[model samples]
Target: MNPNDPKTITDAEWRERLTAEQFHILREAGTERAFTGKYDKFYEDGEYMCAACGTRLFISAAKYNSGCGWPAFTKPADDETVEEHRDTSFGMIRTEVTCGKCGSHLGHVFPDGPPEEGGLRYCINSGALEFVADGDE
Candidate 1:
């Protein structure tokens, strides 16, 4: 993606596409409940994309069993698909990951992951993702 890409949807489009709660959480960087996300028990071969911008963020192959009460991924589908920011909110220093295309806040990334490849855990919110199962219409 280009460095000068626009990172938001039109106001009308956002209003039409999402509910108030979804818009607040996905677009405004709000957080959802710990175990209330949709993808916490998701186990399928597919791609996880940003609900706001449809940007492919994680692949089924990259998902792992983190047991952190959330869907975990060891790596993103592509490095550029998600952008990381230094989040100092909530009185903690964490790396926040958001969709690069629309800047929708998904969740945070942590270094205390399995000692496998990448060695990082992308703890994501299910409200921020849409799973497209493999070979589904």
Candidate 2:
């Protein structure tokens, strides 16, 4: 599937392409346990892409340990790569981040973050992403 146009894929195709857990989080807007994600503590230099559509969402340079129990980044690789929406679930108002290509739920973006760095925390799910090491890409 082309990362630039994931909406072309049908729901059945998404179910067939992703695992149960991935489908739950990416498609159903579910979240993984805090601090349990594979990339929560991962600090290797790399680029993080949308697991479903392979859209480049973040980079190692922007990744930071915010003690938020998830992979946090100061910013995405490009603003256009992610789409933010006002989420009002669970009695809380928050901004939900999704892959611009496929509209898959990645996580949320919070205002609390290192002020020195953009002051935005991109709390992302590892299951929603796939990493490609700097040199391996």
Candidate 3:
């Protein structure tokens, strides 16, 4: 909320810290249109962190192609960076993913993942993540 208060940032501060597009998607829960996200075709070894909070959410090793027009992962980078809750939004039942540290909405988890593992898919929006390139590792 309050981006500068350290507890939570004010909406005004968030607007200043992020571009209009980032703010719209991150703070306002606006979805980036399908197939247009930067990570849709990405294939590199790195970690994906929260764009707003810098908390690591996924590792490159967990990424996969679900043809869902967004970056998808079979699992999170770690179990601690995300929290899952049952979402009843849109009149459908689903598992919602949020940041563990700041509670920023990341995306949702589905059961249609790669069947070899468990068919669990963590469908994430690329706008929700800030990828730290492998070179930075």
Tell me, what's the RMSD of every candidate?
A: 2.9, 2.0, 2.4
Over 43-110, each residue of candidate 1 has an lDDT whose tens digit, in order, gives: 89999999887889999888877888888998889979999999999899999998888888899999
Q: Looking at candidate 3, what is the lDDT of residue 71? A: 93
The TM-score measured for candidate 1 stands at 0.89
Instruction: Please tell me which model should have the higher TM-score, number 2 or number 3.
Output: 2
Whole-model lDDT per candidate: 0.84, 0.94, 0.83
Clashes of each: 0, 0, 7
Candidate 1 achieves a global lDDT of 0.84
Residue 45 of model 2: what lDDT? 93
**lDDT leaderboard ranking:** 2, 1, 3
Clash pairs, candidate 1, are: none
Q: For model 3, how does the per-residue alpha-carbon lDDT over 1-137 read when each residue is reduced to its tens digit?
A: 55343338767877787777677777776678889999988988899998877889999989998999889999987779889989887899988888777676778899899998668899888888989888895
In candidate 2, the residue pairs with backbone N, CA or C atoms under 3 Å apart (3 or more residues apart, or in different chains) clash, namely none
Candidate 2 per-residue lDDT over residues 1-137, each given as its tens digit:
66547787877989999998899999999999999999999999989999998999999999999998999999999969999999999999999999998899999999998999979999999999999998896
Name the top lDDT candidate: 2
